[model samples]
Target chain A: MNTQTIPPLAPDAPVVLEMTNISKSFGAVTALVDVSIRLRQGEVLALVGDNGAGKSTLIKILSGFHQPDTGTIVSQGKEVRFASPRDARAHGIETVYQDLALIGDLSVFHNMFLGREYHKRVLGLNLLDNRKMREQAQLYLDTLGISIPSVNSTVDLLSGGQRQCIAVARSIYSSPKILVLDEPLAALGVRESAHVLGLIQNLRQQRQVSVILIVHNYNQIFEVCDRINFLHSGEIALDASTADTSEEELIRIVKSGLGRKAIDAAAAQVRPGPA
Target chain B: MPPTAIQPTKKNAVGVKVPRTMREQLLILLSRYREASIAVVAIVLVIYFQLGSDGGFLSPSFMSVVLRDTGRLGLIATAEVMLMITGEIDLSLSAIFSIAPYIMALLSVTYGVPLAVGAVIGVLIGILVGAINGIVTVRFKVPSLITTVGTLFFLQGIVVSIYNSQPIVAPVEQPFNAIFGQSLYQPTDALLSWHGVTAFTPFLWALLVVLVLALVLNRTTFGLHTIATGSNIIGAREIGVRTDRMKIYNFMIAGGCAAFAGIINTAQFTSADPQAGSPFLTLQAIAAAVIGGTSLLGGSGTVIGALIGAFVVASLNNGLVMIGAQATVSDIYLGAAIIAAMILSIQVDRLRTRRRV
Candidate 1:
């Protein structure tokens, strides 16, 4: 890997997101412990780990879906604790899960404006302002560069790519400070994945939005991320600038942890065979 | 707009809505007004048949009978429509309806209480029955159809055991009897009676209640929530909507309505029959709501449509009887109509979805 200057986590960097010494446990299972990371303004942080490496647990804690047993999360230098997902959202942190939480039968406008729908005065006060919601959904889709047969169209009729775009657009339209995408490109086709990657790049370049992308593929990380955070054994094994580390070093740390285990030698197959 | 600001986009690449075909438009129109059409057809057919077969079918006495008949079934149908919209079926309502009069009879005859107090006690019995239904479904998570059916039989048995299958009657005073036991139209039983006019009963009250509920269901936020919770419970819950509470309330409403229907029936006859309203529990509701274009799946139904649907069902029965037809024949016709409406609703939903494509 080419050697380049890796920016240090400093107060002068204008950090948008900061997590210090976060630890979480679910009953007897220790999901994450002593994890700390910093995200600068307009930077994408790629979080990669194996299946049981507590990626989901960490995301849940950050997004306020799960409370960390021992940790303090600070947003923009202010100590913050989220009691619920809504609370996290209030602080401009949003997580778009794999399911997308989109209903199939409802119109796009209805789905987008759910829980907080704009209402118009009807004959004084007793009617729905459906026109406003429809127009608002239109404006959002326009901003996201998405096309469909009117905002009245049921989301089920939209393509998989369109649905993901809808989810992304819905989160970002409200101008969330940090957009947490969970496996966004996982089940998408080549075309859909390309569209999503383009969207991510645009979000960073054009909108200057910060992303905390949870992905399994290291190629995706190297392609789009400014920094890579490697998690193993419920802890941050390595957090380095993408330019300062190769894929080889990541493999080395993951394999070394497995080599010490006494179980049926499964780590050799996953990392690589002895050469 | 600034040059850097993103511009609006089109819904389709073609930049046009896929206009609904004429045939498709017709079908959509038919579906929207299917209940109304059914109701109109039923009314015309009833009058035509009454004219052909019975000389007295269009008479004032016959008209009064129709109102009395429609009132009992209309109230029951209202209960069913409300319950069904919440994805629940209350079979116990039939039994509750059957014994509500007994509650009044027991209060008045056995306890020597005033008739007004007896009537109040009877309505309370209705409230209690609804509460039981709500509790069972909420606590056990068992499907309401099964729970309600079990309660139906249990309540029926209790009624029969208490009443010995005999009708109970108590001496009600002039004013109490007048309000509950007479019809609004032709206030006196005999128009040219020598005695003072006795007020009409039951029918107007049922109609008023149905009209008010229709307003409540259509013109209120509660109505919108009802459809939302019924159609997509998970979606509603995700938005912090209290869905379980809505269902529990719906159960209570249906129960209370059924009891009121029973009270109305007892008032009309001034007697208590333990077996009253036994068969009409699900049937009347199914008929009214389905006829009114209310999706049996819940999420989509109108109170006005349900009321109209009730009239259609009532007319079908009344019309058949006026034509000297048997109840069996009417049942067969109603069954066919139910199947047709279900098919129509399914088609309408498909067309709506296809419009997006």
Candidate 2:
């Protein structure tokens, strides 16, 4: 895999979100154990793992879909608790699930303004300001450099890449401080994946939006992500900056189920840095 | 880019720009609007009936009958359109319709309650039943079809047992009938009088209801949320849409509309029948909604389309009679028309999809 070289975040960049020793379980099955991750401001952190590696569990916890059995989450400088997805959203955390959460029968603008619709009172009745929404949706898409036929076009007609981009754009439009994306490109072709990657890169440049991207492809991680966190057996086995890691090492670590100690040794060999 | 800058343009093979012909343009427009296709069907039926009946179908008296039929069916179908868009169906709406008018007549004649007040109470009962259906289906996670079917039989039984399979005549001196269902005007000579085009009060009420609902569905946030709920319940809930409330509200609206339709029926005939709301009436409402391009599967529909669908169904019944067809033959033709309309709509949907590609 070809790794693209991008500027690394400053070492002194403040952490915007921190999850410490998070653990969760379902009935008798342990989905996550002592998992922790940190997100820096304006950084794209790729969370990579095989299927059933507890990546979804961790993401759901952060997005307020599931509660961690043990742990605390700190946003900015203060500890916070999310009781529901809406609560998490209110605290500036937005998640775009794999399904995109888009109503396929609705138009693009309608999907963009799904939950937060604009309204104008006419004859004492609050009617949807469709014209305003259409204009704003078009403006937002254009500003993000996303292209589609029309805002009025129904979402189902769009390609997978377009849909994924729309989902991301919607999250960004809400101006969330941290955006969590779950397997956004899992169903896209090579070209479509490239389209989404380009969108992520563009978003990083355009705003101070922090991202937690859950993906399976190493190439995608190297292409747009600033850092990588590898989950193995419900724990984060590897956490390193992309600048100090190689695809061969990542592949080896992922394939062998190497624990955090081995990854620390490997990371140390590549770069002697404070543990 | 500005919203208007992104006009939909067609590209053919090799990515060359292709200007569409007038016929193709019209077809594309028709495909975009679900109501347009049904509107075309209604118009064609009208012209055919006018010619087949040697202009007699266009007579004011005959037109009055068609309008009245359309109005009653349209009211029920409008309610169905709202409920269906939320991925719910109210089979009990017919039962509500049957019982509401009986309750009104019972209160007005038996208890000597004010006619207007009794009518309002009757409609409220319909709303209450609808809320119950909504609550049971949503809270218990019961399939709406099963819940509504249960209510349907339960309410029907109540109507039959209470009224004892008898009919009650509405008070002839009640002036509320004039506003609800009495004819406003009739053409004296029947020479295409526009003033008497829509003489039936029920037709007028249907027209008013359809226009208001069309506005609500197309222009209101609640309508959009309703569409979202029907389109994807999980997605809607994720966005904090309170989808259960939306479903309940739609049910209430369905019940209210159905009850109003029953009241109109009572007003028009000046009587309330214990066996008024039959399964056939429920089927006709569903049929009207479907023929007007509303999907039974939900997520997409138009109120205007439902009204036009009712018109098509009513016109076929009226025209078939005017042409001297037997009742059984007319039933066959109506069934065939429903199937044909469904097929045509599906084809149009395919055409739209292909054109987009």
Candidate 3:
């Protein structure tokens, strides 16, 4: 497997958000146990694990879809709590679930402005401001360099890659501080996955954004993200910079349980210090 | 092909490139050409009846009666289409239609209640029944089709037992008849006699109701939310849209329209028949919606399509009678016409899609 050369992050790079010792369970099944990850501004962080490694559970917690049983979420150095997904949105946290991120029946513009619609009063009725919305939707897509046949086209007519791009564009449009993407490249082909990776990279450069991407593609992780956090058996078994690791190393750590010493050594190498 | 190689614009007569407006582009791209094809079929059917019946079908008196029938059927279909667009079905709507007028008659004639107040009571009962349907479906997590079927029989039974399956005559001197049944002017000649029969009042009321509903569905935020909900319930909930409330509101609108239709019937005929709202009405409403291009599976529909659908149905029945077809033959003809319209629309859609591809 090809690996990108290591480039150490600036020692003083700021942490935008931190999840500390987060643990959660469902009745008799423990999904996540004492797993924590930190995200930095202007960086793409990959959250990697096998199926049932509690990656989704951790993401759902951050998105406020599921409350953690035990943890403290510190955003910009202040402890906070989210009551619902809407509440999380108010705090500049957005998530794109694998499915249901966009409604296919609606037009691209409509999906772009879903839940936050612009309206004008006509005869005491609040009617959609279609002109303004259309203009703004075009502007948003243009900024992302996503050219489509028409903004008025229903999403149902778009390709799978285009649909995912629209969902990503909508999440980025809100100018959220942290964007949580769940398995964005799972259902995509190689070219489409590369297209989405390019879009994510563009997003990092264009805004003061932090991304937590749940991906199974190691090539994508090395190509796009700054750091990789390997989750194993409901815990963070390996958290290291993507540049400092190899695909084989990640594979072994994922396929077989990592020893305590190996995990510590890998974690220590990527710790906050000059390498 | 490279993205830059495709140019969608066309030059106009003045040698200036005119950008296609969103409206025009939408018309070009709309996937549901069923409405347009259905409309063409409707026009052709009208001409066919006029020719087949030797001008009897187009006679003002017959056309006027057909229009009145179209109004009632159109209103019911409108309500059904809206509800269907929200991804639910209401079988109890026919029962609501049957019971509403009787409630008005019982209140005003038997209990000495005022006519206006009684009408309000009647409409309120429709809404109450709708609320029941909504709650039973949403709160209990029951499939709407099954829940509504149960309510259909239950409400029918209640109406039958209350009125003892007997028809109630609406008093002619009452104000209810004056507003709902009043003819605009008396007909003096055969050509003008169509208006004289009932003043086209019911059809006018139906047109107004459909226009208002079409506005509500197309021009308002509620309509967008409804489409979103029907398209994907989970997606809608994720965006904080209260889908339950949308469904319930649709149910109330349907029930209210059915009640209004009942009042219109009482006004036109000056009588409330206990057996007025039959299961056949439910089938007719569904048929109109489907024939008009409303998807039975939900997520997409149009009110104008339902209107046209209702007209086609009314015309079919009226034309069949005017052509002197036997009752059984007329039923078969109506069934065959609906099937043919649906097939024609499908074929037209396939052709358009093929050309586009």
The best candidate by DockQ is 2
Stretches of candidate 1 exceeding 4 Å from the true structure: A1-97, A103-107, A117-148, A151-275, B1-17, B30-64, B67-69, B99-101, B108-132, B163-166, B170-220, B351-357
lDDT of 2 by residue, B276-323 (tens): 889788888888998998887778888889999898889887798888
Each candidate's DockQ: 0.18, 0.42, 0.34
Q: Which ten residues in a row have the lowest lDDT in candidate 3 chain B?
A: B10-19
Candidate 2 predicts chain B with a TM-score of: 0.89
**What's the count of clashing pairs in each model shown?**
6, 0, 0
lDDT tens digits by residue: candidate 1, B170-258? 56666766666554335345654422233335556667778777765654455545655776675455443466777877787877777
lDDT of 2 by residue, A1-275 (tens): 56667776777878899999999999999989999888888899999888898998898889887889999999998999988788889899998987678888899999999878999999999999999999999999888767776788788777666788788788778888888999988877676577778777766766777889999888788888888888887988778888777777788778866676776666556552213
Q: For residues A1-275, what per-residue lDDT tens digits would candidate 1 score against the true structure?
A: 22323333333546888888889988899999888878887788888877778777888788887899998899988999988677888898877776665656456776686556565565675644678778888987876666655687667667666777777777677778888998888866665666677777777766667889988766667667778776777887666676666566655655666522411243323332111
Score candidate 3 by lDDT: 0.78
DockQ, 0 to 1 scale, candidate 2? 0.42
Give all candidate RMSDs, comma-separated: 7.0, 4.2, 5.0
On TM-score, the leading prediction is 2
Candidate closest to the true structure, highest lDDT: 2
Looking at candidate 1, what is the lDDT of residue A252?
63
Q: What is the lDDT ranking, best to worst?
A: 2, 3, 1
